[model samples]
Target: MTKEAWDGTVTKKSRGLLDGSSMYRRLELRLTDGSTVKVRVSRDLWDAVSEGDQVTKAAGEDPVKQ
Candidate 1:
């Protein structure tokens, strides 16, 4: 199904360095419909989130590419 926004609760969090410099962060979430989704966000955004936190992202905006 298509969605305009992604609303979910974070279930897991991971962080690492890319190319030994840039930081990368990933979050595993449980959507409202019981589906799991993984999304990558920037270090700044990552710091604003934590496991168990609820978050919403614009459908077309890819956080990972930021």
Candidate 2:
């Protein structure tokens, strides 16, 4: 499917850690239009975001290039 940008607020976040450090992360968002979307993200980007933070991201894209 084609991808598009969507604005949303982060609703949830989680991480995968290795060796006592975060290696991967994921974010779940509630879209402005009231839809839910989830995306896997890098640890750096994940660290930069928090619950209730507004963000823009491309939908239908793998790896969620925020």
Candidate 3:
């Protein structure tokens, strides 16, 4: 399970909790090589994205909105 691909813009969208009952969804990207990454997504791709909204996650799939 090591497949990775990226393209990004969405500069933050978040939710948290991960040992206090487990809940998580996050995206804080700014990639396209200008680095900055934080991704833990699902929950329908974090409610279908927001922030600056331009996203892609190819390898094995699950991020969209581009």
On residues 1-66, what C-alpha lDDT tens digit does candidate 2 reach at each position?
347778788999977764576566779989889999886776767888879888776676533324
Judging by lDDT against the true structure, name the best candidate: 3
Query: Over the stretch 3-63, how does candidate 1's per-residue lDDT look in tens digits?
Result: 3577788889998886799877889889889999877776776888777888777777644
What's the lDDT of the predicted structure labeled candidate 2? 0.74
When 2 and 3 are scored with TM-score, the better candidate is: 2
lDDT of each: 0.74, 0.74, 0.86
Model 3 over residues 1-66: C-alpha lDDT tens digits?
A: 237888999988889797789898889999989999988888887898789989888898777788
Clashes of 2: 0
RMSD of each: 4.9, 4.5, 10.1
Better of 1 and 2 by TM-score: 1
Candidate 2 error regions (>4 Å): 17-22, 58-66
Q: What's the lDDT for residue 36 in model 3?
A: 92
